[model samples]
Target: MYNKSHAQMPMDRSPPFSSSSSDSSQFSSTSSSPAKSMRVVLSIECLKGSSKADEWTGDMLQTGDIVEELRIGNMIVKSPFKNGKSGIQKILHGSFKQKETSIRVRVRRGCADLAELQACIVPGDQFVGRKQYVLRAIDDPNYAVGFIDRTESQCLDLQASRTSRMVSALERTPLQDGYVSYPWERRLVEMLSIPNSSSFYSVLFLPKSSDKASARYNDLEDTLARAHTWINASQASGVPIVFMNIQTESLLTKISGDTASSTVNAGSLSDLSNIANTSLYGFEDYHGVDLGVVRAVRLWFSPLAGEIPIEIRIKDTDTRLGFAISRTPEGFIYISSVIEGADDVPSARSGLSSLYKQASQSARLLVVSRISNQKLLPWMVSATGAIRCFDTVSLSQKLSLHRHTRVPILVHVYLWDRSANNANVGSIRARAMSTSPPTPPSTEAHLKMTARGVEEGEEDSDEEETVASDGQEDITIERDTAGEFSFRLHDFALKNNWV
Candidate 1:
């Protein structure tokens, strides 16, 4: 996982390199785009299993790195790759094998034409998952990606065309807003029904994390892209967007700073000061929107004072980061999870019960708990109104249910016996494994696993146990990766008129 912060790129900037073959006759056109040119720097995790340290001396080249065969001081050196991956082999298996190894690559930027470079190297299955170094395109200094190990810093330049095209997609997506709520589905639907109610809506955005920075999926990019789409669509449709800007406290530092503060504000995203400098959601030049910082507000905070609208607050209660969509006499509302919390289903349900009582008088509620916990099933049936209960055993099953429900759902995972510190990533992994199919080994499995391991925990690990930093077995119940846990819970709430 290569993690980077969210900094909006300017609009319509020309691609740093010429796409024309005449200008770039030397480099092959196989690879194009900023993401393609990124030289994914291998990290300590990448070399974790190596029996001996591997070395690189520009051993390979990205197919897209080709430029005119250079007469560098009258020495003709040819490039050996195309499009970053092994393009010569049409066999899919060959490509998978190439990505499993760690190899260095250098992408040449100027002098057009890759014919001379391609002519020298025999194309085959050698460069599959080989580590690549993309030198900065001459056009844009900021455009470069590769394995940047502390021991060795190698890179390859790319065409300006790659940068322009890659960054173009990023520019179109502007950050908007994010949200979260408790477990009560009815409460979420009711709160989300309020229109243009800012105070009740707490904007949620993903903060940059150390794990996130090194993450492979670029969650910030994905998050920002989502925000952009949501804001654009909602604004065009006249739906108000409530965004939450919550700060994440580093457990490591807080322990050293003051153990007392750590315990007082340990698990929740209550602290607003720990946010990274670049973790804000804003465009480079957009000036129309005011309020420089998105607020760290939650709908739960409103009922205490009774200032914000109750409908918006209801929507904000998305426990398990579930999803919800409601159509009431008031208006249409979409409820979704913007961030996740450390609470379990039982605790979340309690908070939600209180919130629902505040938001509406005749609100109905729907709930979903792990089917494995048969004891908890009856408690759900005891809830107010016609509570619809689903017997879902895993998160993936919850997603399957979501495909059919347009309303929000509440998903609960119980780690009642687990501690917080140990509850780290293992909990999320358990949720994913419980819902999805196990991956079968393939030729590319080594590279793919190593790549994922470098940034995130392995999906297939023997140990299902997780311990919190405080030596507590952190127990967590969450929605599956598909986000259906939330959706299903909310849908039940609306269909049964929980709110």
Candidate 2:
């Protein structure tokens, strides 16, 4: 994945370079040439529609570079490839093929036509899904833009043209409070969304929430063009736009959840972060593809719900407690993991492990509800009908309390078993829950395997033999990949046949 943060080009006049590649040199000699000629013909994950890498012809000539000609359909576009960019290319150049001429690319600012387009989409302008823009004509408002999607052709080419006229465009779209796609912009998303019959197309970045969806469609000059008057991205609002050229294979894997097809070696959701890079991934189908089947992204990566507050008396700080804490986006704070060696700590010896049985083995993350007298955010029910939220800034002061200085602190952890049972009995309404008092924390040192609180139709896994145990044969458990769990567990059980 050729990763580079993209920035939208500023509004300006005159296209970055002349339309003709003929003016470019077959050899590099910019010092004597006047035209700064180049064209980036690579697929941008966010800009191109096809979930595959694409290439096109470029006029940027350089010395000692191998430029292969790609014959796609009737188009003989030069494949814009560079040797130094790929390790395999280096190997080939040094040993096998012996082609010293390696390609070098200078990625210009994103959006080559920022100056002429003048970044202006007035009210009532619509985008059709296929890169077509239907807006007021620059020359005459009555005569709408017949066609604006053609790149190899003129800016105003039509199936029927009254006259050959050049329409001057705005320099910039002017970044405003309203959402706007940078680098590829909204236009490029549509362009990519348009079907590619000749070759595959790739985008620069992962599309924002509604990147594939267009509000409107137009069929001017008999060409399909997607048009959206409004900007896309409800989840990306206020988030800075970062232009990145991720691998096309990566986007497909995350979008389709197909690990076998992924080229970036993305085994987990964290690995695909460079693509969507947002926290709004619902543990469901990405786009329309169910993640359960493809098994591309790890679902249980971030499980924090709210601020979790834990209080413990100062024990010896040198013992190196195995317990670790993590956060979730939902606002639930919980004990993420408890190291096995934590039993050596003074507090664990006294009874902390008793309070955290399965938690020690990473069986489950224990949710913390309160610390001593103070209740953690949202978890506490108050008569004022208010849910206290955690302020990391102020709360960190208490969490950072010196172990050697502080006395024993009462830690109130939410027992998952009790929570499940309570929910099973009947879920408490927010109104009633707001007035409830904290439940007495359970302090059992060795909870049973049944204490895991498995839901109906799901049995306890601990009853089955561990993979390391004797008389255990590993079996595959078919499961939904998009579910809370990303991978299927290898069930090790006693081999028995009773039909």
What tens-digit string does per-residue lDDT give for candidate 2 at 261-332? 222323456645433322122234334433321111111111112222244555655322333333222233
Model 2: lowest-lDDT 10 consecutive positions: 222-231
> Which predicted model would earn the best lDDT?
2
Q: How accurate locally is residue 358 in candidate 1, as Cα lDDT from 0 to 100? A: 26
What ranges in model 2 sit over 4 Å off? Answer: 1-311, 316-322, 354-364, 379-388, 391-397, 418-424, 427-499
For model 1, give the 10-residue run with minimal summed lDDT: 1-10
TM-score of each: 0.16, 0.21
